[model samples]
Target: MVSTIDSPEYTEDTFISRLLTKVPTPAGEGFAPGDDAAIIELEGVRFLGCADGLIEGVHFDLGTCSPADAGWKSLAVNLSDIAAMGGTPTSALVVLEARLGEADGESAAQAAYEGLGECARSFGVVISGGDVVSADRLALSVTVLGELPAVGEALLRSGARPGDLVCVTGRLGEAAMALATAIPSGTDHPWAERLHRPVPRLEEGRAIAAAGGSAAIDISDGLLLDLSRLCCASGVGARLDTAAVPRPAAAEWQGSGAQRVAPEQLEKAALGGGDDYELCFTIREPLLTRLDELWPEYGADYCVIGEIFEGSGIEGPDGRLDPAGWDHVASGRRSLE
Candidate 1:
């Protein structure tokens, strides 16, 4: 199935049709694409494997984006998902589409690798192996491997229940605004750093795990779109508080190239903007209280943005989370970070 750019086929079948044609699923091996990480048994352990990529002009601009940040984001985004599943990342493989005539392969690759290595070192993950090849544009891909404990539940997009409180770690929309500018050239904005090099909330994931929470996903696809994903997976619906969703500092938006969006518009961007990499999850009201009690120890603010409702898709008290967020097929972007 040749999915056209105009068609923007966002359905699961569009991805499934392409995958099944390539690798036929057998017995219980369900290679569904939307899940954070693919489940494949290895050496009697359930291993989670995930891969992410970035391309020039899609995920980053060739002229503006830094090679180091590009490299770091390519892997850091994947690690975020691994953490969302309450798993500890152990290994990674990187592939680079070497860009010629613009940047030297050795220097460019080294800068990118250095950034990637920095994040990997922080996460205690190893760089195993990867391949380098020539391409017209800068393209980087990283595949991450992680292991989950043998017993108990793996945090998933599904499992959010009605009445469960929706909460998020860290703020949102800062990254979208960061991408709106020319980064690596430096920005006067204080919040800009959060966008260029987002820190994955590995500690928060561990905290949630230790506290016995369920139903979680990394907020790479904006709050609403990601919540839609969780709702779809769990066969439920969500209602979010419009006022509660976090917005970037007023000072950052001032004098920035980004459109002078209104407060609500900025809130919308925060809600729908992708690449925040924060954790969004649902937990029983009881557990929500427990997290509230313990989150002080973690030194982060987790806001109760909404609650699970019966139905499908996500909704804000005001309305549907307007305009939707980024979609690879629809937006002509390379892929969701």
Candidate 2:
């Protein structure tokens, strides 16, 4: 029998309560969602778990985005969450919601699966299980399970200490620009790639873990907002230099270059735009020096953009947090220029 979400009004508040009630909780369940990654102990090892969802208009636009990229992005973002915890993704469960009359839904679905499968194969992750259902629009949700090499070895947002260096993998602002402007068909820019197809730095996460990254977060919600989260979680503050943030071909891309991003508009994209998916982390000064020595192997652009301070708040270039950072509930296409 197909189950229905019945009982009580389906308001957002009650919906959450009813959803939890339906799932049977076994006795001594060690981990659950609502955290960065759920933790469960099995075979004397700590496992990290995470789930992410992408809706039709919210996470993507079918008109401009490729189904393959849509699929890749759905899984990639979840992997990013695992990366934030300093864990390596090992398995996943995919769920798809497809709409009728959407020009070959099965083909789109298959393409989506292909994208997910490609990314999974590249990352050495297994697609253990999944589900499919009909809906008004395309929806994809992925749950990723990962393992930490050792107990208490996972990095978290709460571990940043005062005087630690704030560093980021890869440049910023390109993704935001891609969303703002339309990339012509058959056109390609590394900046647009940053927006459409993000590469989750799993290897870099392992490297950071090995190099002792005390605190870490993936750059999904723009640098300024995400770093603020790190500071708030760690009971600390940070000072970031605007000029130090990496940009795409700063000299050549100033006017009609490959990236097509103006330098003046670069700051907002780096600070307020979302979906960069690179790792932002804090490490001791000593570890930062070590990273500098072995940086070439990682291959991603790593830069020390800020430093953690002993307090509660965040600051950007010129020493004050930008009030215009991206707000999920408040900011959208209407707010951007």
Candidate 3:
């Protein structure tokens, strides 16, 4: 079915619908095509695999961040995908695209690789072999493999029920606010590290798995976009309480930008903005209570922001939420990113 997604013009959703129709890469065993990762078996063990990429002019700008940060984020994005599947990240293969034979390019590429290595070490993932090819600009494509923890089954987006409680981990919209220049974001800025080095909710995902969540996704795209993916997969709908969405405080509205916005409009940033690598999931009342008790141990704040319902669309406090998010197609542009 063609999903208008509240937009008449062609959008990422349109491209995905066409891709699913034309390509039709259905999963032979586990879920595929629409999921963050593919589940495949190796020696009777299931593993989650996914890939993500970042380009110089598309995902980031050197003026705003360093080459090292690019490498870290490139891998972090893939890890978040694995975490969404309720899997433990194991290893990664990186393809670095850079301009060869240039002194500056060589140096930047080394720094980027070093940064990737740092993230790998932090996450206890091994850096498997990969390729480096010459390109016009700096870019990285990473493939990550994650094994299911011995206890819990891998989560899927297509599992939500009508009575599931919609929940999210951590605050949202810092990246959008930073990119909009709605707030300051440089070295020593409040949003600097958050936008660059996002913390993937691996542990929280495991907690969700343990608590028996009905569905889940990583909020890499905006909450509306990603949550809609879960709903579409599960054939359910949602009603979001925007006031319950965890976001910046009123004092955090210290926008340096000249065009001031009302606090109500800013709530859209938390719902519609992207780049917050937190986990959003749906669970039953019992699981919700379990997760509430488990939250403190997971060491991340969470909020119950909505509920799954018997329908095919999303409704918010204001009305239908725009299923908009960071346009990864041109992520470097302020408006798109």
lDDT values of the candidates?
0.73, 0.74, 0.79
Model 1 pairs whose backbones collide:
none
Report clash pairs, candidate 3. none
lDDT of 3 by residue, 1-337 (tens): 4445455545665676677877757457565666788887768767889999999988787778789988888999999998888788999999999988998898889989987988898888998889999988999999999887445677889999998899998888766666666332346655556678777888888878877887889998889889988998999999999889987554554543345545754576687777878888988987677766655474468888999999977899878886776654423232433
Q: TM-scores of the models, in the given order?
A: 0.87, 0.84, 0.89
* Candidate 2, residue 39: how far the Cα is off, in Å: 2.4
lDDT of 1 by residue, 1-337 (tens): 6666456555443565566778744345334555687766767667788988888767776466677878888888998988787777899998888675565755777788788888888889999999988887678888999876333356777778888888888888877756654344245564556666777776677666556676888988677777787887889988888688887775667656555556765676687787878898888888765566545465346788889888876777767764366655555441223
Name model 1 segments beyond 4 Å from true.
Answer: 1-13, 16-22, 26-33, 100-105, 149-152, 181-185, 255-261, 292-299, 333-337
Instruction: Report the lDDT tens digits of candidate 2 across residue range 149-223.
Output: 342367777889999999998887777777777653124666667776788877777677767888888887778
User: Which candidate model has the greater lDDT, 1 or 3?
Assistant: 3
Candidate 3 Cα outliers beyond 4 Å, as residue runs:
1-9, 20-29, 182-186, 253-262, 296-298, 328-337
**Highest lDDT, which number?**
3
Better of 2 and 3 by lDDT: 3
Candidate 2 local Cα displacement, residue 105, angstroms = 2.0
Best by TM-score: 3
**Distance (Å) between predicted and true CA of 89, model 3?**
0.3
RMSD of 1: 3.6
